[model samples]
Target: MDGAEREVATLLEQLQGLTSNAEQVEGFRRVQEIVQHRDPSGAERRVLRGALPLLGQIVQLRNAALVTSILQLVAQEASSASSTVTTASAETLDVAAALSAGLYEVCHTVLLLSHSTEKNVVLALQLALGSLHSTFEVALRAETVENGLDTEPRRAWDAATRCLEAAAGIVAIVPEATGSDSNRSAMVWLRAWKFVESGVMLLSTAQDSSVYRDPARSNIQPNTWSLDRLSAGTQAILPKTKLEEFGVMLLKAMCEAVTSKSDNRLPLQRRELSVAVNSLSLLASLRPQHMPNILPKLTALSTVVATPGTEDPVVQKSLTANLVKLLSHPSAQVFADEVTDILIAVGASQRAFSAISKSKEQRRKYTSAPTEASLRRARIGKRTATQSITERVENANAHAKRRRVNLSESSATPIPAEKHWQLKKVRSECVILGSGETQDSKHRAKNNQHWCQFLMK
Candidate 1:
């Protein structure tokens, strides 16, 4: 690497060390100087990007005192810049965007940490309101509301619907207005609402309530990219798949599948549903492709049956009332003649009747990432021979005899499709970046190249 790049790389390592309280002051002081003295147009911009890890660390700290301090600092600096600041630099808007994003991501993450104390949660919400306050105040002086933050780690926008709605419903928004004249109760609520949408969008990118996660959904392990053919990331993927984009889609579609309007039927995006079932059938050596559209309907029903918070045992019973229902009903024959966990999850009393678990072991061989494939192959092979014998036995029993029988017999049947799901575990082990080493590691790795210190910690 060139000398300039090496210098920037070194800066990232130093920044990560700014985590303790004493170092924090120095961190902010440097930040203050950057916002106050540097321009975004040149090499200083790289410094700004490199500096974000400290900001990320700040958000992770969850100390109300620190959050408030940074909030006020960013707001004060942006507002104090001269009106001519618009022509001289894009500083106000950029800083405001960064602060808003930081606030939203941190608050949203904190609320999701089921392990956090009530105090931390309250502080997070308060930080949220402070962020909102800065958002609107910035509007009073800043020219635009467009975001200029990096998009790695992807914002949780799709999950922000509720926050946006609540922000819109607040009463007595704008007030009477004039030039810094009246001691204030005279501000324009209407103009404030104009920025409200943008403001809401900014916060909702995170601070999005619908996306709140339980600590149950956090990361399982770090992906340490090593040189040897041996790798270990596969064990990490399966647990969190259901919380991914497609998994969320699967969850949403199943929840909406059979409304009161559709008694005998279940609805789903047949295309995506096929991709999923197809993968399962192909892997299990079953032929679900025979009734492409027909089987997925049953599969969607199975998902709804397994989804957490679905309390009505009647739904499970209605599905189980008769044996013929098992074969002829929509979900019964999902993959040709195979009776499977797909049926068991819905309370099928008889033998599970399908073969899906054993086939999953084969999944290791097909993994494509060289590192991950090696990792899985080595771990599963070795672990299976000795350490994983019990786990392997448990894996088989999970699909075969014990749980399936109990499920068929009891009304309290919750087929253990995925372990550790919430409200009784619906198989949602997503990689939550709320607060922990995993969050810090992933966030750093995501921004490391262009904007961070070190790869994922």
Candidate 2:
């Protein structure tokens, strides 16, 4: 090796030996100097190439001082204005892969150090996780339509999956990360879920074959990539059965989180609950039968809704609507009547009844009763409103049935013809209301219309 190469290698070895944080920082500064010089010499290039992997090793060791030093080098290297520095490839993969690897290493380090009793180590780990999340966000934005469709997409998927799996592993090892005291962990998990949600949204959009065709020609911006592709890639590395098992494990974790009686209100737990609800919603869309499996957890969530004066109206609405939809399913009829009763009780409060009564009283006091002109006017108005509502309800049901049929036909390959037919039957059994001709039918029709709209929306 040349003199510069020898010098870099020696510095790297020496950096590894530095026991003190100050010494490690100094060593990293020196390495940054050599890398910044843009020396094309063999030694400098080799050392620059070697830095990432070696840093990765340091991260695995859970050496806070070493990880910080490595991050400093990366930040410095990243900040250089020279085109050579900016364009300088890692001799690893592109910037995406390098960033992903760095994130993976950081996650591993954080998981390892999360158990440390030392406050500083934990704090450092949290900082590193935040840095890693920011880096991934940058990488995620840099993805283009071409890159999203090519090998880069797969790498992106793998990287994200790795980060999520690592986070899950960390939480498993250190349950305290999801506990009330660890705001950092809560933030980390929230960031991860945001990424995952973005991924799922992208996948849902990309499932349209038209999106992939002429990826560059389309106006569709590549904001996110497919989770199915990510899951498939992970399944290839892991096993299909194992992937299914992992999904079940996540569901179990969610169930525990929902049911756990702890008073500790961690933001991570809330984030996890949101993730779990979205996941359950996705699974219900994919496999309606699985809705029953998650019903108990949904029921637990409903109790939260049942709690009065919660500031989260959105969460309450989502939980109640989801429960109602599940109950409306044919397989869930055992709880359908119960859900209907709850909806009635919640929807028709004394306030609403009082408002209706006050309006009737005002009408009676202001206008003469039993007048033919007023009665005819009211009849015409009611008929028009009833007709409009009937049309809307019919249109919505038609749209929903069409969606169910399309989804069923699309999966005809995996689903037995008998089962597919059964699904259609269950879907048909879901009642759709028409315009009412009688007072009792009108009330029942309005209730059915209201419930259907709530569930469909």
- lDDT by residue (tens digit), candidate 2, 44-74: 3444555656665555443556555565555
Q: How close is candidate 2 to the true structure, as a TM-score?
A: 0.45
- True-vs-predicted CA distance for residue 163, candidate 1, Å: 6.5
Residue 109 in candidate 2, Cα distance off native in Å: 2.6
Candidate 1's displacement at residue 346, Å, is: 47
Q: In model 2, what lDDT does residue 387 have?
A: 86
- What Cα-based lDDT does every candidate model obtain? 0.37, 0.47
Q: Which 10 successive residues of model 1 have the least lDDT summed?
A: 220-229
Model 2 ranges with Cα > 4 A deviation? 1-6, 36-46, 60-66, 69-99, 115-162, 170-185, 192-224, 227-256, 261-296, 304-318, 321-342, 348-457
Q: In candidate 1, what are the lDDT values of residues 1-457, reduced to their tens digit?
A: 3443345445435645656765655655655565446544342244444444455555455344455555455334323432232343345444444444544555554444434344444444444544443443333223232342223212212212222323232212222234442211122222222223233222211211112111101221111111111222331211223223332332223223232224443232333223333222221121111234334444555555545644345444433332222343232334534435455655552534422322222222211224666677776776645567788778898778876686566545443433222313211222335555565666554543322111111
Clashes of each: 9, 1
Best by lDDT: 2
